[model samples]
Structures are given as C-alpha cells and as structure tokens.
Target: MGRILMKGNEAIGEAAIRAGCLNYFAYPITPQSEVAEYLSRRMPEVGGVFLQGESEVAVGYMIFGAAGCGARVFTTSSSPGISLMSEALSYISGAECPAVFVNIMRGGPGLGGILPSQADYFQATKGGGHGDYRLLVMAPAGVQEAVEMVMKAFPLAEKYRNPVMILGDGLIGQMMEPVEFPDELKSEPSNNDDWATSGMETRKSSRRNLVKSLFLDSEQLEAHNRVLKAKYDRMRREEVRYEPYNLEADYKALIVSYGTMSRVCRTAVDILKVEGFEVGMVRPQTLFPFPEKAIEEAVRRESCKVAVSIEMSMGQMVEDVERSVRGRCPVEWFGKSGGDVPTPEEVIDAVKSFVKELI
Candidate 1:
C-alpha cells in the first residue's frame, strides 16, 4: 500500500488488522480511544471481531481468553486503563499467552490529565503487576514507527508466547503523519495445536489443551518463572534496538531518550551541532532490552565528558542510564512530568549546561 496520511491511533488499528490480528478487546480512554473507534468499524468489514469491554479489567481477560485459544488479540489504552489491566497482564504472562498492548501515556499518579507524559516508563520497563515477569516493551517516536511496531509486535509476541507493549506518549496518538501499511508485515496466525486451547475437534486430536497461570506447587511455579526469565534474558541479548544520532561526531555529552521525547532531543542535538557543540543521542527502540551496550559505548568516547537522560518524566529512565554508564562518566537527568512538554529549545539549553560544564 502507498503512504497515507493517518492519525497515530487509526494507524495502529489498521496495522493490527493488516498483521492478521482479528480479535480486539478494549475500553475507551483519552488519547487512545480513537484506536477502538477506528477498529470498531474496520474490524467488521474485515470479518474480524471488535468488542468494547465494560471496563479495562474485562478487556484484559478478554485478551487472555482469545490468546489462550491461539488467536491474535490486542488492545489499546492509556495510563489508568492499563493499570486496571495489570493483573490480567500478569496472568497472561504467567500462562505464557501471546498478546499485544498499546499504551498511549498521559500525565498522572492518579486520574492525572489527558495530556502527554512518559511517567509510565518505570511501570512498563520494570514490572507493573505482581510477580517477576517482564513485558517486551517497544517505544515509538512517531506515527510511522508506531504503525511499524504495532505490526511487528504480533510476531514477536508469538515468538516467545508472551505479551508485548508499544509505549507511546499522547502526542504520538493525537498527531497525524503519512504511513504505509507494509505487505511484508502482514502475518498469519500461529499454529497452536501444541499449546493453544484451540478446539480439539478442529485439530482432530483427543488431547486436551489446558491453559492456566495458577501453579499450586512451589517447584512448578519456580520452574515456570525460570523459563520466563530465560526468555527475558534472550530479549536483552537479541532484541536490544536503538538509533544513534550525532555520535559520528566527537561529542562532549551523550543524551539517552526515547519515544516522543527523543524527537525533541534529536532536534536539540542538531541545533547544538549548528552552535558548534557536538552532542550525541541514543534513541532506544525497545524499552525492556534497553540499549545498555550502546549507552556504554557512547559514554566511553574520550570526547564525551557526561551522559544525560532527557525524558518526559521527571527522572525515571535515569536509573537505567546510570546502570548502563556504570560510572564511566557522570549521568544526569532533565525533564518535566506534567502536561507541558519540554521544547527543543529547552532541551538545547539543558544540553548546553551539560556540555559547557566540561569546557
């Protein structure tokens, strides 16, 4: 398909349909409700199912049910809505079900506001629900990236039999950009005769397929957790993705950022370059398998005197940045958590402070 101008939310819905995900369960929430709105009409035309659950909690279980049956299922929600679905996410993860979730974040500790925010970085990269499970998290900087990640998320979920999350801020959802629905990204559903509770008659087998997260035996549960941890470790080694900017130049400060916030930092890098200050940026594409090695490499540059984590939240991702740096150089953070997004000029100023301190 040719590139079409589309809102980020609608593009996500279209990308999922193109990826052969026929089941969608979600409840309306600010900034991301358009995903449900778009799919509600589109799914029926595609011979797919789109159901709006009474609440996000219900939607979470709905996803778990379809996934256990070996169906490609997905949902979209904002902060609080995703919080409601956290328990179900843990359940689905524990049961080893493949599902997709899109979180278009908005500001908040509570009801917050319907504005862009990256405060959920911890909730996403760390663990939101109980237990020791991790979600394979991808952060997109724009609408096209969002569409691409949505399409790719399905196959990745099936690859590990785990849930995947596309983490984007509110701006990514509300903005419009040209995007192409790639034919190559369209995927067929996985053959789940081995694990999925797909009907026995359909598979022409008498063996019963049972799916449940509950493990009464301590050893069994610990064994299951070990298997899950192995998958996460593999992700760290194989799925670490990032884009480096201005690193080719001898930079004095390295900036680590992601999602919509990275775009701002990228602009800051360019402007600083024009002002005769070489700054580097590492934009993480995958949040879970964060580009730790990339950050370490960037900071080791003799020209680089300091590393700064620029984010939408006050200072959440800085912790990970610190771990990656490992005291190779000083690590600092600059951000705002409220609705007011930090402008490119503000980022430039912040980078200038870090760069000038060394000189």
Candidate 2:
C-alpha cells in the first residue's frame, strides 16, 4: 500500500497483522491502547484472534499459552503493565517459547504517569523478570522504525526460541507519522510442527512435545542456562544493530540515546552543527545486545573528548553507556523524569557544558 499518515500505536498494530501474527492478547493501557483498539477491528476481519484480557497478568499467561503451542503471539503494554507481566515473561523465557512483546513505555516507578518515558530501559535490557534470561529488545525511534521492528520481532523470536520486545516511548505510540506497510510481511503461518505442542495425532510422531520451565535436577537446570547463554552470545555477535549520525567527520563529543530521545538528540546535533560544534550520535536499534562496540569506536576518536547520554528517564540508559565507554572518557547523563521529555535546547546545553569542561 501507499504511504499514509498513521499514529505510531496504530501502525504497530497493523504491522503485527501484516507480520503474520494472528494470536494477539493484551489489555488496554494508555499510550498503547490504540494498538488493541485498532487490532480489535482488524483481526477478526482477517480471521485472526484478538483478545482483551481482564488484566495485564491474565494477558501474560494467555501469551505464554499461545506461544507454547507454537503460534506467533504477542502483547502490548506500558511500564506498569509490563511489571505485572514480569512473572509470565520469566516463565516464557525459561520455557524457550517464541513470543513478542511491545512496550510503549510511560513514566514510572509505580503508576508513575501516562506520558512518554524511557524509564524501562533497565527492566527491558536487563532482566525485568527473574532468572538468567534476556529479551531481544529493539528500540525504535519513530513510527516507521516501530513498524519494521514489529515485523522483524516474530521471526527473531522463532529463530532464537526466545522473547523479542519492540521498545518504544509514548511519543512513538501516540504521535502521527507517515508509513508504508511492507507487502512482503503479509501474514503467513509459520511451520512449528517440529517442536510445537501440536497433538500427537497432528504430529504423527511417537514422542510428544512438552513445553515447561521446570527442572527438578540442578545439573539439568544449569545445562539449560548454558544453552540460553549461548543463544544470547550469538545474538550479541550477530544481531547488534545501531545507526550513526553526523559521524562522517571527526566530532568532539558523542551522544548515546535511543527510542524517541534519539530523535531529539539528532535535532540537537543539527542545532550544534549550525553553530560550528561537531557532535555525533550512536542510536542503538537493539537495546539488549547493546551496540557497545559502536559506542567505543565513536568515542575512540581523539577529538571526541566525552560522551553523554540524553534520555527521558533519570539516567537509566546511562549505565549501559558508561559500561560501553569503559572509562575511556568521562561519561555523563542529562535527563528528565516523570513524563518530562528533554528538549533539544536542553541537550544542546548539556553538550556545551561537556565541551566547556573538555576545554
């Protein structure tokens, strides 16, 4: 189809439909409710299942059940709702079920606010639930990127037999943008007969597939953990994705940001460039297998004296930025919490301050 102006949440919902995801379970939550609202109308028309669970907790289990059966299933929620789904997320990971989750993050520690925020950075990239598990987290800065990530999430989940998350801020879910749905992503059912919990008669095999996370023996649990670790390592080596902006020439400072905050940082970079300051950015597309090496390369430049993380939370992502930098240079953070988005001018000011310190 041709390009059309669509809200970010609606675009993601459409993208999921186009990605062959027929099983969707979710509950309405601010900033991302449009996803459910759009799908409720579209899914049935396409002979897909759309369900609004009683609560986030219920939806999590529903997703677990669908994914265990080897169906391409997904759910969407904001920050607080994500917290409620943590238990199921842990179970899904341990069970190695292929599932996708979209988090249109809002400000929060607890029922923080309905406005856009990136406070879930730690929860998403790190372990939101318990156990040694990781989610292939994709952070999208715009609606178009969100569409692409949502389309990609399913295959990645199936390929790794792990959960994949499309991480976006409320701005990405609520704002309007022009997008064209890719015809290549039209829904096609994935073949899951190999390991999916299809009935014995359906599989026509002697053995039955059991999907569970429980391990009575400590050695078996350790072996399972090692297998999960290997998968994460493979993702780190092969799936780390990022975009570099204004890095063609030498820069004095590097800015690390993702999601909607990266867009703001790009504008700040433009503003600074106009005033004869060279500031570059590394916008991470994959949050879990963070583009650490990319950040290191950007700051390795002699002219790049410092790195700054501009975020919408109270410096949650800065930890990763710092770890990536690894004491190569001083890393600092500038952010606003509780739904306050940092303005381009504020980021510009932060960059100028860092430059002054370098001088």
Candidate 3:
C-alpha cells in the first residue's frame, strides 16, 4: 500500500494482503521463513488468520481447511516442505478451490541444502503431485516483480478456481529492494459460498455445499479432467506473460530465462552490450503458460545465432525454451543445482563461450 524497502519474502506476504488474501497457513522453513514470520506479526494487526502449523503436512491441510471455509488462503515453503504439501495441493486443485502457494525454491532430490535454487521449476509448472493437475506458476525476476506477481496471484486463482504459485528462489526471498503498491483499497466480492463449507440455511433455501477432491468412478474422473483441460487451455490462451528486453535491432542472440536467473541474463546482456554484442533476452513472467510466442519471435530474429537458457537447475526451463524456439535457432543450456546459482558474471562467460562456438 506504500513505498518501502522490503525483502522479496516480505513483499509476497504484503502483496497477499493487498490482493485481499486474509488467511495464511505455513510452517517455518529455510529461505522462506521470513514470509511466515512477516505475516505472523502482520495478520493479527489486520485481523486475519496467520498460522504456523506443526509441519508442512499440517500446514497444507490447514490451508485446505481455510479454503474449504471459503476464505482466500495462502501458504509458503521451500523445496522439501513443498514436496510434503503436494498431496494437499493436488486435492486443492481437484476441489477447484481458489488458493495461493509460494515456493521459495531450494535445491533438492532429498534434504537439499538451504540456499536459492530454481530446481523446483518443473515441480511448480508441471504439477509436483500425482494425477493431472496444473497451477499458475509465476516467476518474478526481481523484488518489484515478486510483489506484483503475488498481487496478481490471488485474482488469477479466483478467476480459475485453482491453486497459483509464486515460484522464486531463496535469493529472491532474502534479497531486498524497493516496492510500491496502490493506496486505495478496492476489495472484490467473495465467490466462496458456491462451494465453501459454510453452515447450511445461511443462504436460505439453498442446499449445503461440499468441497472435496474425491471421485471413485472412471467416467467421473474423465469429466473432471475435461473441466481441468479447458481451464488450462483458457489459461494458455490468456495468461502467457513474458518480457522481451533489448530488442529492436537484430540481435546476436536471445537469452531465455526466468526468475532470478532471468535477472542474471539481463546482467549478461548488459555486459555483452558494453562489448558491442547484440544480445537480447526473453524472460517469462508466467512459467506455467510458458510464453511460447515471444520466445519464438526472439529465436527468429535475423541477428540471433542461438538461444541459450541459463537456469539454476538442470535445465527444466530449457525444455520449454527449446519447445518455443522449435529448431529455429541452436539452443544451449548452462545450469547448476543443489543450492548453487550462477552470478551475472558467470552468465556472461557462458554466453561468450556460446557465441564463440557459433562464430
């Protein structure tokens, strides 16, 4: 609601409030603990629910409880904790409950180190849990984007009646920067009663509502999947957000990236520019939709020789980049995992090496 210097984690919690999410349920976990800590103090002041559950399992269930009660609820956790919550997250999507989850990603296969990693990109975008489900996974490149991405998450969640995740790295969670928000408080009408577990007779002559993800029959499951498919299709058509940077002149190359990795690409682009290289970047803001069109256009630029995907993981986003580029340009990947992130300088070196090969 005002201009302030805030860590990315704190900004996410604040943006939830700005977006009219009044309930937060989470456990303390590395890299993202500040999110819960911020809301724990701020929620009481605003008369909202802030709960620190015993474990990630309980935290996710707590979110389910709040969502079932027809409240706009949210939660935050790191890689392993998010893994623990995947069961409930799948259930939440199956119930078509509008909710938000933030994953300040960390490296992992099991018990990964506590530093920033985009290793969960696939998990967030491809549905970490079982069965066919998808979430709106937004990757914010910087603190401002993190704040706004979170604010957008609530409305998108309600619009689609599905879970949305703000997927950032621990660098994002710990890093600080300036953020601004609207002053006027405009609240939206709640659509919770149509499916929420509120008491009966409150709406007078309406039947009770049941919120659940259970369906035993194959035909029923088919019908459910069809509904989900249509929703995902609509999102693909309407919400594929991306940003193209330093493009007007033909470019030497296009860098494909997202989140903090995208910011690193930007820095690489700047260094390349100083050296008279014509490189640009196409950064996806909404990871789920994958921003296929902009990436395609970037790959087609006449000066573009290749598109390099730099990620903090073993190239999850690289898969999407290649799909978008569609053989128009050579695509290379440079990445690290297990809690490692490449700095802008390292990214520049990688890009230069890539360019040298093409030359």
The superposed Cα distance between candidate 2 and the true structure at residue 240, in angstroms, equals 0.6
Error of 3 at 309 (Å): 0.9
Clash list (residue pairs), candidate 1: none
Error of 3 at 65 (Å): 1.8
Lowest lDDT block of 10, candidate 1: 350-359
Model 1 gets an lDDT of 0.94
Clashing pairs in 2: none
As for lDDT, the candidate ahead, 2 or 3, is: 2
**Global lDDT scores for all candidate models:** 0.94, 0.92, 0.87
Query: 1-359 in candidate 1: lDDT tens per residue?
Result: 57899999999999999998989999999999999999999999999999999999999999999999999999999999999999999999999999999999999989999999999999998989999999999999999999999999999999999999999999999999999988999998777898899899989888999999998999998998899999999999998899999999999999999999999999888888898889899999999989999999999999999999999898999999999999999898999988888999999888888767867
Separately for all candidates shown, the number of backbone clashes (residues 3 or more apart, or on different chains) is 0, 0, 1
Tens digit per residue, CA lDDT, model 3, 164-265: 998999999999999986543335736666777866765553777888888899999899899999999999999999888998757887888888888878
**Candidate 2 regions with alpha-carbon error over 4 angstroms:** 186-189
lDDT of 1 at 53: 97
| TM-score per candidate, chains pooled | 0.98, 0.98, 0.95
Clashing pairs in 3: 252-278
